[model samples]
Target: MSCQEPEFVTAEDVGGFDDLWSSYGFYNEGCFEKGAPLVLNDQQLFSDFAFMDDMHFDSISSAISVAAETDQPASNSELLQLDEKSTPPLPSKTSELLSKYQFKFNARSGEKPNESIERGGSKLSTEDFMRIAASFFIQLSTHKDCNPFMLNNQFGLSFSGLSSAEIMNVELAILLFSAAEKVSQQRFDHGTNLIKECYKLCSKTGNSVQRVVYYFADALQERIHGGKGTVVKAQEVMKALLSNHPVHLATFRSLPLEQIMQFTSVQTILDNLGSAKKIHLIDLSIKHGLQWTILMQALSNSSSVDYVKISAVGTSEEEITSTGKRLTSFAEILKLPFVFKPVIVSDIKELKEDMFKIEETETIALYSSMDMNTMIIKPDRLENVMKVIRNLRPQIVTVVDVEAKHNSRSFINRFTEALFYFSAFFDCLENCMRGDERVRMIVEEDFFSPGISSIVAAEGSERVIRQVGIDVWRLFFARYGLVEAELNQWSVYQASLLVKHFACGESYSFEVNGKALLVGWKGTPLHFISAWKFQ
Candidate 1:
């Protein structure tokens, strides 16, 4: 199962629309093309898992069993040390991979998701919002037009080894900081003060690990956004800010929309008479069981569905446990029979890492809310995922991932585009204000210096700015014969929330430095496409 074999294909192999389409079996067969590739026919992807074409499932079983017996459980102190180990070292091999695929400076002329103009309206649609949200990751992974230096400038500064969580730590920090800057109040006083405070706290507790930096950065950004202008650095004041400061990382599981949609979708699908018996919910990063909670509720309400079991897999036990707790709490609150099993994996090699050996293939269904490319970027890994999908022969295989392009060609543009868009947001706002001093201070002092966008633009940085992750995911899905479906209701709810809370009644269409950009609240429905495998 070692991916020692290298089958590298140049961008030319799959570059042109016609060439790429033919190579991937997209144009020839209509089965692959569909709406956005949010989640496609679940059955097709997992159907291959049942076919054991020299797949070493037994090997995985043996390895898992051995690991279970030989592994010594780490205590609290050991666990804390383990957390420390999560911080990845700088100059990672993946850093180059990231740098190669920067965000693009694509025109923002594309239609907004579910936006409307009624003096007040939703900004996007459920389908479009999901696509956009997913696109965020796509832009991060594939686009190449962005500033690549940001990765090093921000989180890549230092690291022992970069784990997926560490990468996410940096990404999450950048995302939150950017979001805060866009929506924060008292930009000048609050933003700077928060950054300084976070810096001091990190110094006392730990160094500038990606997680710490991001956490502090995000918190400061959030506080500033919340209109908190307190100026007290953690160390200089010689006093603690609070009696007890809890780690306040915003969990995606907390997003009611995602939670509700996932649960509802699973239940709705399973309740159908033709639905399969066994159901699986696969998520790349299961922070908490918030998603499963909703699923559990939906399953409970279903008249046909009796017992729904969940196998929630993530990168680490900490993540699994966090998700498990959410599922457990949901059960406690609703009093349902929903059991969520947790499986922790460090890399894609572990997909079958501990899969139990069986004499014959099982009709197992698979679902994933993660980047499909993560499993396929490497040939062997990609084949492994495909092998698993083929073997399971699941009636359904719903995969949710960023569909952005990070291939050899579009890497630079992706990052550049992201930087441009972020810069544009601030620049547009600044222009609107006629160059306000406070705005300038916010941009120059707190916003510009260490922003993730800025980091991507830095020299030798692996970071790239991209439009968003969701759109790229949709395209990727189409390439793979996964049919897109209509946007889920939860997405619609999120779109509504953004419009209700964050919409500004200003419609201005202007080119930013020759790049067409659209800024305003127009009632244009966010375009969301879903794909299905008709075959």
Candidate 2:
């Protein structure tokens, strides 16, 4: 919640991207300091207990026992009865429960569950299991007075009647919780054992729940064993992913979320530039530069536009060069005079105004998508990046990022938030991809899995996937003398139309939060795109 001015370190002080990746334990300094733990009084505890009356507890107990003992899957009628008796608490009630129990639940409003569980035949859906298991684990993990391993004896809970899949997921959640607890307590050996057990039940190739649990377990294992090798391997995966244009393009096409971001960002840039004849774009993390193609095509139609230049900032020279070639080729086909400048940098904080070679006459616009969050671990670096942008005096800056609160200092809080956030995301993928397992797996494993690992496994500065909501970003940007540039109504309409073009796109919804545009699945806001200009 506060920012501490740390001594700035130059690129030479920190070796390169490899060194930055290898180094962990960089605290956020004063920013996002862990707040004092909430203490629950006896009266508050009684009130919370009153909310879960005897009928609810009895129904939950009966359901657990029935699910554990029965060989056949529970019928919809039976499940519905149980669900009615012991329904998952609503978001407000859930927060109260977590608070009373001395746990934190800061999941976004978009992550709230629907009024009713979406029944899929006799068996519970993966998402349903995730919700149940997450709640169950919360109770088990926070009960410091009782031993979680002896839940049957200590809490009178049974795992007998549930389906095999349900049992597997619940067991994995328990193991993961136990392992995380051990890691936090610095009991590496015990945590490692629990992690191994988690691996036994988890599968990256299994259902969405299993895939996510598998990655969480992997992260815990890495956390226990000093994750240098894991970091190196992740870097390799990212490098390969960035260099592969076809895969990137396919991902961009398959996922409407990316297109929503890219389209909205491009539209915002075009709208803000007016009739500028010469425009320069500075992309902070221009992986494959696919977004610019849309901008170039838009500009090609404008008679007043004379020249377009894109100064792409990235880590890999080869990848940037490759992206330049593609964008250059696309520009030629459109008959637009274009230049692609690859502004390669070892670290984003190393970015300087001189590297961009800006002109006095050219109108400047900056774009960032899922990039700024990485710089968050180091506040000074993030500040420096912001300073660079502010100094550039861009006409407009567009930013699109995943919308979630995953920057908590508390592991369990962050873990819970991530569980819900990714649960919604995975559900979105399942609905959108439908039968295309291959593409879904590629997107999940290649693009998202690394982020999950970083969030769960790494700690301090090493934990790089520190995504926050727009409210936090608004405050951060405001400190750097940037103000929100309202996105026009047409951009919102265009984004909605783009969503309709996809098969399951109707599930995706948009909202204009102040000047920003939020695209969410169902009711959950997964991403937000907003424009900014210097104050």
lDDT of 1 at 6: 13
In model 1, what lDDT does residue 179 have? 31
lDDT of 1 at 422: 37
- Look at candidate 1 and tell me the lDDT of residue 223: 38
TM-score of each: 0.40, 0.70
* Residue 197 accuracy (lDDT) in model 1: 32
Best by the TM-score measure: 2
Where is model 1 more than 4 Å wrong at Cα? 1-278, 353-365, 373-379, 402-412, 421-481, 486-534
lDDT (CA) for every model shown? 0.34, 0.63
